[model samples]
Target chain A: MKAAAAARIMPALVWAAAALALWQSGAWLLQQRGVALASSKLPYPYLVAVALFRNAGSLLAEAAVTLLNACEGFLLGAAAGVALALFMSLSATMERIAAPYAVASQMVPILGLAPIVYAIFRDENTARVLIAGYISFFPVALHTLRGLQSVRQEDRDLLHVLACGRAASYRVLRLPAALPGMFTGLKAAAPLAVTGAILVELMGAQRGIGVLMLRHLYYGPTHAALFWCTVLLAAALGIAAYGITAALENTLLPWSRTSGRRQGRGLR
Target chain B: MSMPYSTSSARSGKEASGKVEAERASGVSEHVAVLVTVEATAEGALKGDGEAGAADAARQYGAADPTAEAEAGVELGAAAGAEVGAEASDASAAADDRNRTRTSPKAAPAEKGRFMQQGTAAWALPLGAGLALAAIWQAGLIHAVLGLAAYQLPLPSAIFRAAADNAGLLFRSAGYTLLEAAAGIAAGTLLGWLAAAMAAAMPRWGSGALLLAASLGAVPIVALAPIMNLWLGDGLASRAAVAAAATLAPMAIGSYRGLTSADSASMDLMNVLGAGAVPAFFKLRLPSSLPAMLTAFKISTAGGLIAAMVSEFFYSSRGLGYLLSNSVKIARMPLGWACIGAAAAAGIGMYMLVQAAERRLLLWHPEFRRRLS
Candidate 1:
């Protein structure tokens, strides 16, 4: 297994090394062609790295704000979705009443409502979070509803035979059964929350990663490298959030390991 | 489990012959077992199946007596008469409720399944809320709200009027935007799929190229737009190029995964059959990857529109995105909203088109069949 892993890793490592060499030589070739075009505004990768290091503090602060908003929105939306799923599960009438609204919410682009919510809320961070939350909530709700619904008949029968109350039945059967679906929703929504936060920030926010990117765009040259850096930072943040969600799924839903392994097999 | 045996004994006289009938039925048990296993596995993921089953059962029970003139009349009326339909549906539902309770003492699973049906039905509420909100805005409630704060959010009526009046221009611009989006998506999907194919075929150099594509994909549209604008000039071409660049990485990654991720057992079987790479890809890999490709296509469709809009924000003079930006600058809030609406409609239309195409192409896929059934 170790040997197989090493063999698999070898190709990727070689490819990376080759690409880096090519990139460096390409940069050198561009310099040979003309220093003006090569080094102007957006410099080579090395120069951008240097600029990123220099302005790390301010950029990191901005990134932190955006991260906070994304996290806040993801949590709130996920909780609300779970609550709504539970409520709908409690009664057929309530589920019927809520179904159309949920579909409409998912279909309509939440960005369209961002301006209105921002106008109403006034506070930039809060409004951004609200928009993110709104954007992120639907998937969670849909998935949780799915999860709640997926509780097996046999399990429910066992619970009934055990004379379990509603709360106990939910604790033992529904919640555990729903965990995989809920986590799937959470994983899907994580990157979307970041995207939503950025969209709100772009629409009208005083500070955050989106604001920083826009500012860099408008300012030009002086902040050109910084702009690319900010974008890279945002991408990294999205990837990180995705990783964290995956990690959480593994930690919180151990039973999903079997399904996850199957999925992984399918991937390979 | 005990109830089945008890019930069988209780009706022994009728059921003795019924046993003979049931044994004959059990002769087809293999087929039934396969169906039940499939249903059970499906039900594991999709709780909606139970309601759908109930709906099917209702339909069956209602339609069972084809020669019963009054029942047939009622059945026909159910389609055309809402009241009749509602009453019949209710009766069928009640029957289902009793059937469920009797057959499964633990009604929780079936009840929860009904929750999904209820959720789908509840879609009406949000539609109503949206309509009511629109009506309120039209009735000057929005103006009143804005007036309190001294802000100038355009009234819903005004926006509607603007949308109606500029319908032709909006449609034309929408067409142009849609064309660019479609063209960009096609180009991106082709390039991405080719890259994925090349990567999969030759993993030696493909990994690095894949990484480069991903990095390029990660580059924000705002940053990429200026470069593309420089390369293609401030025309629709630039915007299209931006959209293509934005969409490519996702498709590549998705397609690569779909194409190369064949089951080893399947791959081994193909190998044993002496299948060539091309045949293996077409027969084994391609079919297996259809769902992933569709997912990527859907993602790219949305991404392409966004890219076109963002690109147009910087550079073009035509298209809905240009109209939106121009309106924002001129403070024609209603017109801006109208443009936004038009763009959204176009985006949704594109998404629906892809979804429809997916249904046609992947009819055999479990997800597609599950949705349809």
Candidate 2:
């Protein structure tokens, strides 16, 4: 590798080493302080590893459920958003009528909404999906609307001249035109779906990553150790989800890279 | 590719052709084209003539009056008359310009039409989708299907009333939370900016420090919160620390990119002038990076709120997050909803404030100009 590439990779290696060193020193410090309120809890790193191994099966099951919920919610919400965007684009009266509701929806946080959804749905899986869908819906709807609205005028004029019907125009013009924006929304909604599932699980749920986290905190051998472990697992899951979505975005909309670069520069 | 259509006399020919085709194919009279144009022009004038143009168009086009078509013609005539008066007064200035230039008068009007076409091009999909959604919602179909679900979701009316009823408590807690967010944002921004500047100016070791800070920033809020609470204690300090930590990475990355991303030409020019490091940074790099820093600040403002709230889950006794957690524990759903409302309002308010500041600071920037236009 070139020196520049090596230089970039060095930071990741250094960060890992530093994190290990920090963990060791933290353990040494805790030992020196003789803070042994929880004798069953191992030292920092050991406890993390043990918790990981011990709960691996349950953790995987919970993670799978949570991931499934998020995926289902994301797909549904994205579809609804695209539908809404298309509807709004077709008629001014509809846009006017939906404007208030759309704005209101964006303002309502999923954290507050999840419990009510849980109460209504009753079924744990349904409730989790509803909350996840609710949380994921706004970004998709908002971004899809924006994306559809951003279609170049020349393209629309050309379609009109072709005497394309509404459905035909949508299929040939708007859908392709809105892809980049749709992807942007999908990327944003990916993390939000996870967050929604987690929040719903936090509120009230029998199983999921969130429930697992709460279980560890409430029923584990030690609060600190278990909390840290749950956090690590959650973070890894979030990062993994984000990475997958980003990869999908690049694969689906290679043309958007130029615009994305422009936006990045323009932001600066 | 070849500017496909001619600019001069393009609209008249296109409109006439479009009308003839409509008459032949759809059996609709050319008068409908005239009517639609008149109505669209009048509505466009009323709506598009100002900042809330789109809203005005929504209102005008959305009205359900029986005489809508006739009213549109009258409105269009009135708008045209007004425009004529403005044009008459500017005729002298136009004459002077005409004397000095060879460009056709039709050229400007054609360009204007082309620009308007562009504006409306992207607007159709959103407008159409919005209308369809309203139709569904208005038919009371959505309410029926999702009504019970909606109740659990809290109808817009319920959420608004809940906000109004707890206005005092919500506002007070929001104020406290906002103070923490603001302080954290300011501190994080300054520290991050400084670190970025140091890294850019002295690339060897400062860059390493920046990388370390960025990685720390990437650490999840859940992991950082308890540790911060343990270190800083369960007070405003802990929440603030978490917020600060959460915000630090974005600001560092944003400002570092801003600083190092300066144009090579500008850098070379500064060097050629024998400008000192500090002077070059301040004169060339810092000003250029101000917009990015503002963007980072806007992002961090939201991050700060999330961090502060999450931290409150573990530490602190008074912020919105604490209130929310407690309310949830007791199942005081309304109050918990109230707390969520307060946090959302605070977050939105902070975001708007940053946006407002961005507009003020970058008034000359093209993005702001496009937004205003």
Model 1 chain A: weakest 10-residue lDDT segment is A259-268
- Tens digits of lDDT, candidate 2, A55-81: 788777887888898788778877887
Per-residue alpha-carbon lDDT of candidate 1 for residues A36-63, written as tens digits (9 for 90 to 100): 5354333567766898999999999998
Candidates' TM-scores? 0.66, 0.61
Candidate 2 vs. true structure, TM-score: 0.61
> lDDT per residue, candidate 1, B51-125, as tens digits?
333234345445444334234233422322222333234323322233333344244334433554444455556
TM-score of chain A of 1: 0.80
Task: Return the lDDT, model 1, position B207.
Answer: 51
Worst 10-residue stretch by lDDT in candidate 2 chain B?
B1-10
Local distance difference test scores for all models: 0.66, 0.61
